[model samples]
Target: MKLLMAAGIALSLACISAAEAPSNYETYYGGVRVDSDPRLLNHYNRVLAYCDREASLPQRGSPYPYDTWHILALRSCLYRYSFVDRGVHSYPANWFWGHVFEQ
Candidate 1:
């Protein structure tokens, strides 16, 4: 039950953050343009999968949790892929927060 509650809260936060996130801004990583939406989506999905797997692992004495790392990775991927000027927001279903709860 605790896990479910935590997941719910995390999801709520993700959705809220997603709502406020900038949209349709061209993204670049290491001075290189990120021109492919599919590539970014793939990276986001991979990070999410890693987060899920790590969340299921036994807790350790580390300073940062696995979820933290994975979430950051996902965020970075999103940051690198999203466009701010284009204002393109057609596929909400493909967004990270859109289906985070379904995992």
Candidate 2:
């Protein structure tokens, strides 16, 4: 559930085109999301890293549970990019039949 949620969050921030958006998370994606489609790897890995970072930061013995706002903001940012940019709003669903057919 966490992985999927994270993937959804990250995909929201991904670029719709190779030329669009900054390549801020591409390197991270290069390491994860093993699949036949190179594009899926690019999308999933980026989201995975962002979530890992966000979730891990709060786990390093913080005095308080990490701020929900910060986490929500991350997901919101992803949502913004997804909606405004019409980018990959979700994970492999973008590559699935319904989503792919929409393209």
Candidate 3:
């Protein structure tokens, strides 16, 4: 019983950590690359802050996890701030699903 309890605790901890882990969606999608331009960097920082807040909330009418919503929010925020023009316009649908399943 003790061993089983330990295993359960470990599994719970693992799941919690995985859920909270930051997504590499920005890196994969190539939006808002950091550079020497201070103004652009500031804008990037603001976008990140906005996405972080957006990701923290439980998304209504969506079944996906926090990180998945985070990816969507980040992309939207980047496009809203005009950062996407400097990077690739779009990503394949599989890429989004891959991240979703990774969690």
Best by lDDT: 3
TM-score of each candidate? 0.27, 0.25, 0.41
Q: CA lDDT of each candidate?
A: 0.43, 0.43, 0.48
lDDT of 3 at 77: 58
Candidate 3 residue pairs in clash (backbone atoms < 3 Å)? none
Q: How accurate is candidate 3 locally (lDDT)?
A: 0.48
Colliding residue pairs in candidate 1: 24-83, 24-84, 24-85, 25-83, 25-84, 26-83
The candidate scoring highest on TM-score is 3
lDDT of 3 by residue, 9-45 (tens): 7654333211111222233254534554566566567
**Per-residue lDDT over 1-103 for candidate 1, one digit per residue giving the tens place of the 0 to 100 score:** 9999999877654442222122333445343233346675455456445544554444521234334444344444444444222232323334655458668
| TM accuracy, model 1 | 0.27
TM-score of model 3 vs. true structure: 0.41
Tens-digit lDDT track of model 2 for 1-91: 9999999776654423321232322223333223445775566457545643554454432222244434444444444334122236323
